[model samples]
Target: MPCPDGNAGSAGASPRKEPITVTRITDAALEVVATEGYDALTIRRVAAVLDTGPSSLYAHIVNKDDIDDLLVGRLSAEIVLPEPDPAEWRGQLLDVFSQIRDQYLKYPGVSRAALAMVPTNLEALRVREGLFAIALAGGIEPRTAAWALDAISLYVSAYALEQSLVLQRREHPDQEWVVSREELMRRYTADSFPQTRRYAAELTSGTGPDRFAFTLALILDNLCPSA
Candidate 1:
């Protein structure tokens, strides 16, 4: 009689291939963060998205910190660093920082993960090198250049994370702002908040990009006074 299970007995049958990999896991984790915010990102959640058990993820990633590191490293690699121009150092720095900020924004909550991280990853180190080169070429002292890079990086990451939070809030109507701008203005007028009412237009003067440019200019001016 023929074998009861045809495929089970067949020598020509193809073996199942393993689907798990570091890149696939990282991509799934980023998707979770992009769609549901950072707070929703967890090893279990990532595993679920991959249709695998949480235990399977442990073979690749050590912990949540490992995942965060990978996410930061992956995103940092996307930054396109400009060649340092001594005569155009300020503009170069501005362009580089803007690229970093835009990349973080693309990944939503990933910037929050980068806040406390040092540039241990190769890609992150490359970004640091570019910033330092620009500052140094512009005649900034070494120590001052280091400190300025730190401050600028923190500012960009914090700004991106804050914007991500605002976007998340906007996605959920139930968590909308408690006070509308019109209502806040009315309250300010009623309460006789003289300064707020007097300069309301100036206070809300710039769009997001405008405010970002103004703030970047302010930091660069103070950090590279001689430039």
Candidate 2:
């Protein structure tokens, strides 16, 4: 798909088929994602976007994994990690997680590269170091801090992927698949699900941000002393 005139960050019609550089390759990959979605990302796809061939991409990046690392590294550079504040560690973390989520949602499905992978790039490691420093400052033990950060990162990545899929489904708008609020309530009949029926309205009340914050709060509550 040809991105509109100003959406340079999205999929292009292979318009930037110019000289190959690591930076250009990264941008082309993201544009491919923005235009064709993340599932369509590949060595050939990115090379096509860059107006080059797959072998040319391999000269700079080892493979698709390298591209994933580069993409995460680029995004890590964009996230402004706050100075470690002992008293406000929870809030600080909330801000960081929110920032990460927003960035991942921008590219869609890119967070999959981060799951179960070591920080392959300096920028990505910087985020981990920043999170560890903040958590440690808040009195969390070293080992706990490491595991907590990993858990939170996992959830954040999973959440981004799920959200991206939901967005794609919403774009197509299939009524057969989507359960409307009304439809959901009707399914929660008292006989089959009494307690769920009682809290049907409450279950569906929160907006996406509200639910995101609630989950983050649950995870962050016990980490810091003051919470």
Candidate 3:
């Protein structure tokens, strides 16, 4: 079959050619995601970046989900979990969480995708297995460990997504239709939630790492039997 228009082979029979390689499409997609956020990630955009056509991308990646999965898999390769240290499993877990967050933040939109996927890719699976091992070694019940990992993953991914979304909005200030949304919320919240108004500074006290540490401490206090 002929390759899609605007993506014809540089020199070949007819206008047809194989789809762009896995690396090219993914790198292009990552660029778009990092620059434009997930909503801007599309086959056409990736094709534009790759000098290919949407059909060629579809020929290799089934749809948006496939591209998303590929993106997540590519980004997963960056995560580096430390060796499971039985004596310091909690520290190890926090390190892994921070690593995952930092790596995904570089790509901007990958965290949102990671939030929705179970991370079946090899690297993600290995990381999950390692965390499970640490949890088990720490004397956590298998079921509890599994659930705690889920909770932690959800928290990290959601926080990353929200962070990216906020950054994107700030980058494109015109995109925010509700100009007074934050101020309005502050006023309403102050009136309706007096205690929240008083303690709002404390509520939003910490940076990402600080908040992550607080979260870990809270969960560990509940989950770790010795705590």
lDDT of 2: 0.85
Q: How many pairs in model 2 have backbone atoms within 3 A of each other, for residues 3 or more apart or on separate chains, i.e. clashes? A: 0
What is the C-alpha lDDT profile of model 2 across 1-227, one tens digit per residue? 97667766575455554578999998998898888788999999998877677998877988788988998998899989999998899899999989999999998788887787887799998998998889988989888888888998999999899888877777786533666778877887557788988888987788778888888899889775423
lDDT-based ranking, best first?
A: 2, 1, 3
Report the number of the highest-lDDT candidate.
2
TM-score for every candidate vs. truth? Answer: 0.88, 0.87, 0.79
Compared with the true structure, what per-residue lDDT tens digits does model 3 show for residues 56-118?
876677888777777777866777767777788888888887888887778676777776676
Model 3 misses residue 13 by how many Å? 12
**lDDT tens readout by residue for model 1, 137-225:** 89898998898889888998898988888887787899987455677667666546888888776775666778888888998888754
Lowest lDDT 10-mer window, candidate 2? Answer: 9-18
- Lowest lDDT block of 10, candidate 3: 176-185
Q: Which regions of candidate 1 fall more than 4 Å away from where they truly are?
A: 1-17, 178-181, 225-227
Off by over 4 Å in 2: 1-17, 174-176, 224-227
Per-candidate clashes come to 0, 0, 1
For model 1, what is the C-alpha lDDT against the true structure?
0.83
What would the TM-score be for candidate 3 when compared with the true structure?
0.79
